[model samples]
Target chain A: MKIAVDAMGGDFAPLEIVLGSIEAIRENPHMEVVLVGDEQQIFTILKENNEQKNPRITVHHASEVIGMDEHPAQALRKKKDASVVVATALVKDKQCDAVIAPGSTGAAVAAALFGLGRIKGIDRPTIATPIPTVNGVTVMLDSGANANSKPKHLVQGALMGSEYAKLLLGKANPTVGLLSIGEEASKGNEVVLATYPFLKKLKTISFYGNVEGRDIPKGTVDVVVCDGFVGNVVLKFAEGLVTAVTQLVKDGIMAGGIFAKLGALLVKPAIKKIGKRLDHTENGGAPLLGVNGVFIICHGSSKAKEIKTAINIAGDLVDRKIIEHIQKTIEVEGAFKYEYDE
Target chain B: MKIAVDAMGGDFAPLEIVLGSIEAIRENPHMEVVLVGDEQQIFTILKENNEQKNPRITVHHASEVIGMDEHPAQALRKKKDASVVVATALVKDKQCDAVIAPGSTGAAVAAALFGLGRIKGIDRPTIATPIPTVNGVTVMLDSGANANSKPKHLVQGALMGSEYAKLLLGKANPTVGLLSIGEEASKGNEVVLATYPFLKKLKTISFYGNVEGRDIPKGTVDVVVCDGFVGNVVLKFAEGLVTAVTQLVKDGIMAGGIFAKLGALLVKPAIKKIGKRLDHTENGGAPLLGVNGVFIICHGSSKAKEIKTAINIAGDLVDRKIIEHIQKTIEVEGAFKYEYDE
Candidate 1:
């Protein structure tokens, strides 16, 4: 399998992206990587990592790079030769099976929508993010793809999320839950209330009534479906809370004097293990589902390890034929029959 | 001042509620409490706590009790003599200065709207929840009061929340941030986008542009204003994430063998301190702002400590004349001049 990596996308840019791609190719003998960015920068990093002449490693030249803060659609339109768009184009042209971009989420979504286009029946593409829960991970869809969504869009997200959960999380029958403030069918805002009945009537996915915000961390359901607005807020809030909690622990130790310092040293390994489990990098990137091709979006601050994992995840998706599964499920279930305003 | 307590409200109702009220009055020499619930149950708990004949303690009989699982508006309409409604009625009738309900948030909101009514010129009442942050507290308005809100309603919420910060958080000039997925003014859903221009044009609040979900935990602004749907989901998600993190730390310690166990024992005190700092109970209860009377709503699982703090908070709100301040701010700012749909 071959995958295209946008080397000039994230904060670490070409160097870290190149190193991670090299590492990913070394671990998977049958896999190959095409690093899309400035040729000179890619080659210099490859030489420094001692993989410059490796047969499995290749470089594709792209003149422009999109900054982290650039407006996605505008940047994609102006920078026609941008690394992220070029990488996505490789997948569109069937040069690679998948593409990975570790830049602004908006840019990634725009590149996918513009380059590969959406599947036939899907109205909008979604970003399925894996959140670490108590027992395991729960996949939340439309994490930040579309700012505003209709009930039909959420129904499409649920179908796509259910398929992703089955392939990625290894769930036999994924139970989908609508994210809401209350657990009752009669609860939530107008959008949620309208979406609930559609999910209940659907036959392709297991609709698990309604789940509250707390239920996400409790691992109450396999897939959580919501519009991008609420899903994005919840995702970012979880990240912030984890950081604040860790800082609180560090401050507590400082205030405890000498005894707490010694205790922290003794339990350093245990704390490190916990951090690893909760680390976002360990899960790689969230897949931009419903797109025509495989597209994974990593965090902007992603380093070499995260990029490598994301490449491996892209390979797994290709092997499982995730896009094919989503297309078939949507068609068979007739998800497009629901009335939606353009 | 006298405050009415919903003695039949929470999980540990009557017993814990009565004890909390007794403790609150003991701390505030000038304060009195009226326990509104079934007379027999309240008296039995009061006698057990040795406060049956106390001069400052009083009991008002309300034959019906609203269960936690009951629907809010329906239950309020059917069970006219419910404990929560009676407590709120005490404040409406001017028999008590304020009311504290440590039960279903829906019941508290419903009773407040029905009994005390909304403030003049205010379209809806907002729940201003005080979230503990790294620096101090960040007050988020419309946390769960109205699931759906318009731009004008949010503008009213901002004015009410700013006044709340000035009085409760002790901010001389509080800055308010409109919560959105991005920091840019053009980045949120339809409602948030429409609300931005109104907030910027208004002279009452110090508009701090847009803030993301992470800003809430980081204490980036004094007041974070959003419609209740997003605010409620973010609030509950924070609670869930904190619990999940704590459990992760515990599981880590247990997995690291005997040394980790010993380390945990040595650092128990420091850990307890951190836990106390992050505890929601420490902040007491969130006030239902924009109402005609002072109404504080506590968590459903609140214990005696939380109830006590909430009662104390209710007294503080009455002393500060929070309702009058909110009313004045709305009238002075001409917040009702904006066009809105009912």
Candidate 2:
């Protein structure tokens, strides 16, 4: 099996990306990786790190890099050889089983949707990320794929999210919860309220009723589904909050003088572990679900470890035939009713 | 000024309610309190605590109690003399300057909307709460008043929230930010997209365009305005997360052996201060903005101190004429354009 890695994306680009690909292929001896970026940059990193001798890694040269703030569609259209676009194109051309990029999420989504195309009967693809919880992690879908979603899109997201959970989290029957303002079915905006009845009628996924935002960290449901707007806001907020809280604690300890400093030193290791637990980097990458092929989008500041995990996840998804399972779920459950929108 | 207190509401009930009222009136000798609940229960708590002799405190008989889970409109209708409803009635009838309740938020909103009614020319009333940040607090509103809102409603929320920040956080000119998916004005769903232009046009408040969810804790804006659905979800999520993170840290510290244990003891005071800083009780109560009368809603699990703070907040609102200010802002800006929806 082979994977395409975007070697010129994220804050720490070619160096981190190239190192991660080397590490991933070294661990998985059966897998080969095509590093999609500038051939010179990739080769330089490999040589400098004494990893150029690795047989499992090859370079697929791409000239341009997309800015993190670049408009998705415009970036892809203009930079035909962008690392992310080229990486996704490898999967689209059937040269690679999966694509991994630590680039602009919008760019990744745009590239995936346009390059690999959507699966049969899927209206809008979703970006699903697992939020760390006390018990385990909850799969939050449409973490930022479509800003405006129809009811059917959310139902599709639930089914897709459920399958993602089953394969990734190893949950046989993942419970799906609609993200809403209140726990009651009647409580939410028009889209959620309209989607509520449809979700109840779907027999494919185990549908739990509406779950509030508090339910995310509580791990009340295995899969929590919503439109991209709400899901994105919640995801970003959680990420920022974990960092802010950790900083606040450190500042508080620092301001408390010598006794507090001594105590902080004692509990430093425990606090480090706690911080690791709260970090999203521990979860590797978020999957762009509902697309035809495997595309895992990592954080823009992703380091080598996170990229390696993303590669491993991509391999697992391909081996487990997650796309086939999702395709079958949507078909069997008859979730794609185009007439419903009309 | 006289404030009506809902004694039978909240998890702690009449005990905390009575004690808080006593503490409130004792501190503010110029203020009077009406304890609205079953007279026997109120007397039992007051006399048991030997506070029945105070001339500033009086009991108003309320025959019924509304359960926390009871339907809002249904509870107000069925339990006509419910303590929350009666307390609100005191304000509606001009017998009390303000009302404070650590009860079901929905019930309080319903009573205020029905009893006190919307202030003249205000299209919808909003529930505004102060979320603690590293730099003071950011006032967020329509925290959970109307689940569905028109574009004009959000504009009103911003104006009211700005006034709220001024009165509560003491920001003379609060910069209002529309909570959305991105910093760009073009980002967000249909509601926010439509409301953005209105907020930009409104000269009454200093508009800061759009703010993402992370900005809530970052304190990027003085006031963050959104529809009730999003606002309520964010508020609850923040509350739940603070608890979960603190618990995770404590559990981690405990599992780290004797060194960590000793450290925990030493930094315990500093940690306690951080906890208090994050505590919503420190902010006192969330105001039901846009209503004709002042109504401060405390947390359902509020203790004596929290209730006391709510009472104090109510006094401040009444004394500062917050309602009059809100009414003046709305009227001057001409935000109540009922025909605009058409």
Candidate 3:
């Protein structure tokens, strides 16, 4: 149940990652944490804090890091000993059950693919993230994993997204939705129209038909599927909007006066909780589903808390055998089709 | 200038419509309002309020009204003297500078097309709405006037949008951005990709390349051109988001104690102004662009303030001869193409 964490992955790499890993190690003594990064840098960070006493947490040093701007494939090829790559390798070698990185998304994906390989029949890996909705959270797949995709790619996304939703959200045959400009199957551009039929034909999940952007926050469906391009826009807009709004709300509350301070005091906890939920920086990690191994990607700017959450998510996902469940579900689908044919 | 008002449109028709009309009459002295609706209902509403003192604002009675659920084309065909249809006729017959409605968007477009006709070279009439952006307001066209469109429709939308921008926002050659998933000409769905090259070939305005969804509020480009379906989604999302956020901000503010009430009082004026500016409700109304006459369609829930603004917009559009300008711009493209072909 050990997790290999890329300590040098995120914007607040060594310090936040170290602190978060220590938190995890403190919480779970049975599981070990392999903190991958430059040894001296991590040690120095621990020394500055004067709280590096954790038997379960060990520093597994890697001298390299994947820069955010570097091309993902090139970086993976060049930086073989990069923290993300090394961490992924640890997962492949069975040294760790799962790997976590809040670093470069592309780099992490490339390393995971190169190290552990893609799941059979999975042509593309998807980054599935839970979007807040009134009905709970809608798990939207390929949030930005691969921007351009064909109709088949979208079907793959739908399948992968369904598995993730069922595993993570504990849904009974998660209601799946195809994200489109309109709800009607006849609507949307060609890609959507084509994908609609494919998704409808798949019997692994309860295909709830098409959903629009407004349907996301409303929690109209458990699993919303789309190509990376539209999914990316919707996800990014939600991120940017929630961020912009949270700031404005905070600003509105703190608008200079004795009354504002008093008012803030009364609603501070509720506001803080809402802020935490909306903070993609905190809920920054996403499972790169469709890959064979358990891989969780955090935001580039993830801090200590988020990195720890990614690790926790990776642990839970591995424990639940999400990828295996996905395989079994696909197998069941094949069986269903074969039996029908017979 | 005399404006023809749809007195029988919207959810709170004849009431809010009449009240908004009164507000508009009070605000603009030089302008006259012709309220077109059910004679009995109009008289009853006005008499109940006892606001029939003004000679400038007169009621042109009609019994027919278009319901929101009815098909736009069907309603337009069946009810020739419906408020929306008659209002459009007012503009067509030169009885009024423009027509305003807070009713069904489809019926407004249908009736406008039936009565006012299309501007030269503009094959189909499109609904153009001014979205308040970070930079300023951007006039986006085909905001769901026609669902399915050709590449030529997009080009025409661009020309009409550009003309509206220049005339409404007073931007000298406002940069026209093709709304796509990405900035690259090739990076888009079918409709967008097919439209890009055609738009690039046109020279009526400054074509600033493709713009993405998240770029809408970021204030990158001035004119965003898209098909009806996509535009509808964008418009609705923007409307929903702004409404949700501003309400959240206000709710956060009002959560304070007694002192918070005082704090609210301090910034109430400024906050009100912000709300007013961001409020699309008071932006007069969406103009059914590409129509030959100065035809305006107000929101479904328009109040007196919005009605006044719609009338003013009509006067300005008519005074500036916006339709003639659009016609000439299209003619310029046509002449160039004709010469090149020869």
Q: Residue B297's C-alpha lDDT in candidate 1?
A: 94
lDDT of 2 by residue, A167-261 (tens): 98898889999999888886888889999998988888899999998888888999999889888878877776776777788899889999999
For candidate 1, the docking band is medium
Q: Which segments of model 2 are wrong by more than 4 Å?
A: A338-342, B338-342
Q: Pick the candidate with the highest TM-score.
A: 1
lDDT of 3 by residue, A224-342 (tens): 88766566666655554554444444565456455555555655544455455556655548999878799898877888788777777787888899989878876766522321211
User: Which candidate would rank higher by lDDT, 1 or 3?
Assistant: 1
Indicate the fraction of true inter-chain contacts that candidate 3 also forms: 0.10
Q: Rank the candidates by TM-score, best first.
A: 1, 2, 3
Candidate number with the higher TM-score (1 or 3): 1
Candidate 1 wrongly placed segments (more than 4 Å):
A340-342, B340-342
Candidate that would win on DockQ: 1
Using lDDT as the yardstick, the better of models 1 and 2 is 1
lDDT tens per residue, model 1, B1-342: 999999999899988888889889889899999999999998998888888998899999999988888999899889999999998989888999999998899989989998998999898899999988888889999899888888988899999999999988898789999999999887999899999998998887899999898888888999999989888888888788778877888989999999888888888899898788789999888999988899999998888889899988888888898888888888888888886545
Query: Which scores higher on DockQ, 1 or 3?
Result: 1
Clashing pairs in 2: none
Instruction: Please give me the DockQ of candidate 3 compared with the native complex.
Output: 0.22
**What's the residue-level lDDT of B288 in candidate 1?**
92
Best by lDDT: 1
Ranked by TM-score, the better of candidates 2 and 3 is: 2
